[model samples]
Target: LPDVRSQDGFRASLDAIIIMRSNLYTVGRLIEAVMNDNEEEAMDCVKQGADCNQVNKHGAGAIHYVFTDLYLHPPLDLLSKMVANGADVNLRDYEGDTALNLAIKKTSLRPDNTMYKVVDQLMQWGADPTQKDLDGNDALALAENRKYLDIVKLLKKQKTSLIVPPPHETPVPSPRYQKSTTPYESRSPITHSPSPVHPDWGTPVLPAIRSSDPLIAPDREESITSAIEDDNTDELDALLNDPHANLNVPNSMGLFPLHVAILRNNPVSRNDMVQQLLNKGADINVKAIPNEDHDEGGNTPLHMSAARDQLDTVRILLTYDPAISPTNNEGLTPYNYAEQNGNSEMMRLLKEEQRNAERSNKSSTCVIL
Candidate 1:
């Protein structure tokens, strides 16, 4: 049978929503629709009485998932719909992060400025630029600290009167996404405040400060990507320990350290390095930029690993984001890459993981961009 998601039309998925037993499931489907930019389907769900403000198991709403893409820019109109339907523009997720905050973090990882407009829309809809999370860092502070100058500028333009109260005045409900059996601990030493920046370069998020002279070493010698390629656990450990080290920042090739490790193909230590990076806050679904070398520009670590036949690395990444079905620039998923490579084991593992994710619906599972 053809996958319901790949159908010419959206029959199967809509059917799943109709038969869903819980409001939570209905809300989850709404998020899925919004993520895929199916406005008609999403509006139908909303009109059917599914709350646009419903928080999925991940402790986030449709707005939080909208900008998660590293490629395939999301339409700002979708966000407008959620807000129009009374979704909270400033509701914080389990991480105490609002949609604007998440948008700022993700935009820095990619070259596209589409999210800037999304942030602007959110601001116009009353997403408070000065609203702080648990860490006392507001959206403006995060943008500046992360060196998102454009976002900083946009945020600066907004006034406090634009701050809208949450549409649902009730207290936030318990997370629909289950917690991991292992208590999660963040390895990043940097908390939520705006991080220190290099005077001339702005913040170093993904901004590579190249040295003009070969003799002079850049202030920072090792990057998360370099450490992964060298398999230098010691350097990787030291790098992650710094609060300001950007784990999700892509290098010149738009590959995160996790992607580099997958391509490096160090059979003995690559898997270990992958695990180490994830533990230290690496994004399991971080993707590479599109280029001729890849089937599509937006290949994630999973796609790279499957294409290169790194079985162990594939296994490790799945554990972090069991339901990750991210497609590349070509609109092919990691599962497609595995099948194309004729890797039966990779195909089986991804299929099994997809089934399990459907059964359990790890709503708490979030891949921080």
Candidate 2:
């Protein structure tokens, strides 16, 4: 080796080595977080430049650990984050099991809907159910061997050839479709209509919203909706910063962007999305007029959050100055919905937030904008 101390390239060389070492350390931290099942730390490591696909001696990647059942329910949210960070879903461990395979295998430890959700998410994320493991059992075969009919049904329903189109294959949809990976998305074809128009579901959720301009185009709107559903803050920020994006008004569903953020059932990202929307000028007290959805009509985001038993969402909403226990068109407040649903946790959260709101109101000057 040459004496590089006197060379012009020495500083660059040292910086490169330091960067490499930092990356390796972050990767190690990611592994440690995975072993401990600390998704927050894992995400921290990912954000700090840890490679999501970095493997251990056993060849298990971060994706594998997210669904591995060493103990407790798997950190499936971490799996989504890992995939979004470019972790390959089909990558195998030493035992030749993909993340989906391991998730399906976990049904032996605890046969529940959690595993099903993981499996379903992995599939939507482009996991090949046909990929087999060492024992020659593919995802479907493993589900069948385990006698988990729901998984079997899910696998059977997914067409092997049609999950995602190849790059060379040109799609034939008229207006082009923007498919969403979230479970709430319907696998429906795109319609050739004006932006944000619903053919089957005629009219806006609220009559007043019918006059509210969509402002954003269909694909842009869908992308934003998908971002909200996934709690993808980076994507959401980009979308919200778009000149055409509108956060305050109701969509065709008679729901504002804030309402969608409130109703998402993800364990993570609920509060994060809410905070992002609020930062982007989302109205905290905007009422959702979900037409004919029973008493869901005239519900503020708080009422919707309480009625849906979204305790964390309610907690986040309360942090912003909002009307406490604001009644809907049904003459029931958020607390009433929580009580009606028998959600004790939600009720407690609403009660505490109401007290906090009261205290806040007593101290702060009420300035109408």
Q: How many collisions per candidate? A: 5, 0
Candidate 2 Cα outliers beyond 4 Å, as residue runs: 1-6, 108-110, 160-170, 174-369
List all candidate RMSDs to the true structure: 23.7, 15.1
Cand. 2 TM to true fold: 0.45
What TM-score would each prediction reach against the true structure?
0.38, 0.45
List model 2 lDDT by residue over 82-139, tens digit each.
7788888889888889988988777443322355566777888888998888889999
Index of the highest-TM-score prediction: 2
In the predicted model 2, the residue pairs found to clash are none
Considering summed lDDT, which 10 consecutive residues are worst modelled in model 2? 203-212
Q: How many pairs of residues collide in model 1?
A: 5
